[model samples]
Target: MFSKVLVANRGEIACRVIRTLHRMGITAVAIYSEADAGAKHVALADEALCVGPAAANKSYLNIEAVIEAASSTGAEAIHPGYGFLSENVEFARACTAAGITFIGPAEAALEIMGDKIRSKNHVAQAGVPLVEGISEPGLSDEQLISAGEKMTFPVLIKPSAGGGGKGMHVVERPEDLGETLATARRVAKASFGDDTLFIEQLIRSPRHIEVQVLADAQGNVIHLGERECSLQRRHQKVIEEAPSALLDEATRARIGQAACDTARSVDYLGAGTVEFLVSDEEPEKFYFMEMNTRLQVEHPVTEEVTGIDLVEQQIRIAAGQPLSLRQEDITLTGHSVEARIYAEDAEARFMPSAGTIIGLQEPTGEGIRVDSGMLPGLVIGTDYDPMLAKVIATGADRDQALSRLHQALGGTIIHGLTTNTAYLQQLVADEDVRRGQMDTTMIERKLPDLQFPTPQQHHAVAAGLLAAQLKGLHPETAGNQEEGPTGWQPDGWRHSGAQNPVFAVSWQPPGTTAEPQEFDVIVDGSSRLIPVGEGRYLLRSSATATEVHLTAGEGSRQTGTEIWISSGDFTGALSVLDQEAATHRQLAEIEAELTEALPEVTAPMPGTVVAVGVESGHEVNAGDVLVVIEAMKMEHRLAAPTAGTARINVALGDQVSLGQVLAAVEAEQAENTESKD
Candidate 1:
């Protein structure tokens, strides 16, 4: 066993690794970027080092920095947790040359399995079933176009390097293949530093199933049960579980063995995952997608079911230990599910959100486990992945697991920024998802039907009462204002005089584009914010009282003219639209034709411009993607909102902020009217 191991990564994975190392009595070393100096992972480690700047490439992905951090700390081994340098071939070789053990597969395994094209081909040569496609290396655009013409329509384009579904595109139309290829190549270069790509047959109604395999340097390889990762958006997994509901015992054994065989072909070491595209129509048939050379983000679910510590296995394997468990010894005890909670607003097209954490309440109980990266005062930014935590639950059956996960989600609360908590809760209860009748594109199809309602009347009542309590306006407060107008003042709120205070607010739920609906709650002293116990509150609605919050977020306004409220399963941003400065802004908008006059489309989140689809003065109609910006490893396209001559404001490689103007569409009528003027 390693006396000390340096974690060459940040966030929850690093913290998770440190916990295991502590459990095994191994000294843990952690490396962090400047942005993560105060991160939870750094605090959890025995020793820590600042690697580089906030940029991932400079810090977590910097091979030299990570290696030096390990060497200086006298670390015997380095653990690249899931992302950054986890599957990096050069990083592995660097560790070996430096006499520091890499707690993962060797260079051979990383080089072969890290590249999707090579892995697909290598596994195929080993008699592993391959998905039908043109996977020849270094295929040019013309070659892919030529191949597309001969093959069926709707082929999938995947970058040869990198995982987590980045740079993967599905070209549905024959005409769009050329343009789509260019975008994919660009993303591939920017993300993986590899522009090489391959085409694959787009399997419809396919279920994503993957088997977790553990191996050692002695060529002993054993497989754990499979995980279902079909709940996805833009090919990025949102929910994952072990012991796939879609697979039968017979198919499960076959897939598990295939995974073991795939590992054996490369003489794989440590923990690796073999992904397969299983057909929903025929569960028996499965095709190899690609192998993840390092630990997977969804690995916790597998550990829960098999009662095996994969990270421990990786450490042991890297130390040249033989496999501890045989294939027969691995028995999945129960069903486990994991939901990835991201710093994103689910109502706002799932846009990446950034803010300082003012409050937080993670779920905990008999069957629930939370792998969290966030802490109170932790600032979430767009520099790294937006995933803040993962909530996993286990039970005797899938239904129980889903139910526990759902309840756990309702109990979760994070303040100061929006998250996808409510969205995940609704997903677990989805009919299609509950019945195991789902596919890769299930999220997109069912997203429209998922109800992420805006702040209801009860939510307004809760916020109103909470505000009164904080302002000493609640009857429970000992302040003496017997009658007449009283002054109410809260954080970032101006003093307001009223006999009966009225809070005029507008709330926008995540995942919805609808304009904030204005809601007014009158605090006539009938309503009072009272603690019912366990961080929960009760809001009075006339004669009736509604219990709100299993946990609460920043229930009051602070920096911005908005109050974030967590009610039941939902957390919403309530803008103080009718307050002091807000009133003046609304009046100004009405005086000028501001709502209709605004022609510029701005970025919803901060990021670098990746693509410019239109040049200045180019004619475009509504809904044409004019600019693509990459933030938090996700690309968002800014579109022309009206028919006009497009006037782009920002260029490729420009860093933009939230609401920064990207482009302006000069309507023909507006141009004509201006000319006449």
Candidate 2:
């Protein structure tokens, strides 16, 4: 066994590998960027190294830096935990040249499986079933159109070199195929550095099932059942489960054997997952999609059910140890379900959310597990993937596992930043999910029907009360501040004759830009924060008692003292605004009625401007692309609001804050009038 291993990744997966290393008595070395100096993984490791700056390319994906860090730390092997450099074939070769073991598949496997088009061709030769399409490389656009004319109308256009739903598009009409191919080529070229194109038949209502396979250097291989990853949004998995409800024993054995064959075909070593697109109607028919040559983000569910440590297996394989367990020894004991928690707003098309985690609550009980790198004051910036953690649950059956997962999600709390916790809870209980009638399109299809909780008067009251307590009153205000400003105590003050303080506060629900509703909370002199440990508080009143979770944060706003609160399924921010701030916002009702056309183009979220389509004072149509901002590894193109002159305010490479005006459209009417004059 290797005495020391370096984790060339950050966040939750890095922490996960370090934990396994410590359990095995192996020293764990962690590498981090400047932004992650205080990260949880760094604190968990025996040694740490600073790779580079916050930018992923200069840091986590820096091959030379990672190799140097491993050498300096005296690590025998390096683990690339998903994302970043996990699937980089060049990084693996670098480690080998540096005499540091790469704890993943061999170079041959990486070369063959790294490219989707190549993997499909390789696996098909191994007798693995494949979806029908034009998967050959080096085909021109005109040739592809000519070839696609005879195939089905709706087809999938994807890059040959990447996964994770990036650079993949579905074309429904034959006429739209050429246009989509151009867009796909651009995206694929930008994301994967290879514009290699391929076509695949778009399987309708397919269930995504993948088999986890492990092999040693001696060519010994075994399968550990299949995981259902059909719950997805935009091709990224949101939830996963082990021992899929769709597969019977016969089909399970078949798919498992097919996965083993894929591993053998590559002369594979270490842990890998072979993904397949299974027909929802015909459970017996499954087609190979692609192979992931590293640990998957959804690997926890397989670990929970199989009672095996995948990381341990990876290390052992890399150390040239033979397979310790056979296929007969592997058994799926129980059902496990996992929900991915991301720093994103589910209500607003799941846009990435960023900020400091002021408070957190991870559920723990029978059959519940949490794999996370979340710590108080952890700054979730827009530099990398948005997934923060995962919540997994196991049970004797699928129903119980689903039920436990739902309960666990309900108890999960993250304040000071928006998350998909509430949405995950709702998804677990969704009818399609519960009945096992799910497809990859289920989440997007059912998103409109999922009812998220909105803030009410009680929520407002709880937040207001907490805000008042969090910001205590001054001694003078405690006595009588009849003439003083109300916000000296944050919109709360003791009346000259009254015994208690009154908090005139406003509550804003999560994921909204609307004005907060006004609420006056009268806190009795006796009303105080009870000693409730772990973020929960019960506010006692004459009428009723309500419990809310809260955290005092340096608010995003300039003037308000923001108190983040959570009660039941709803989370919101309570702002204590002085009279001037509140009245000014509410008084601007007429301005809200102005035309959205020729509107100010503001940054929807904080990000860096990657592209500027037009220079200042250029004429553009309503749909012309104005600027492109990249955040959380996704590019958002801002377009003109209406036909007008583009007045650009920001240049390329400029860092922008949310709501910062990037440009504005000067209406054509103004241009016409100026021309006439």
Each candidate: RMSD: 3.4, 3.7
| Model 2 agreement with the true structure over 64-101: per-residue lDDT tens digits | 99999999889999999987788889999999999999
lDDT accuracy of residue 641 in candidate 1: 87
Quickly count the clashes in candidate 1: 6
TM-score against truth, every candidate: 0.93, 0.92
Pairs of residues at least 3 apart in sequence or in different chains that clash in candidate 2: none
lDDT of 1 by residue, 1-677 (tens): 78999998888899899999999999999998999988999999999999999988888889999899999989999999887888989988999899999889878989999988888888888887877899889789999999889878789999999698878999998899999999899888888888999998888789999999998888888999899999999899999998899999999999999999999898888999999999999999999999998889999999999899999999988888898798889999989999999999776788999888877889999799999888888989899999999999999999999999999998888888888988898899998899999999889888887777567777776775665555556744323344443553332332554345556766654444566676787666666666886557776546887676523244332222455677766576665432544556666768776556648888888899999998999999999989999999888888888889999888889999988889999888643444543
Report how far residue 320 has shifted in candidate 2, in Å. Answer: 0.8
Candidate 2: Cα lDDT at 74: 94
Show the colliding residue pairs in model 1: 346-510, 346-511, 347-510, 347-511, 347-512, 348-511
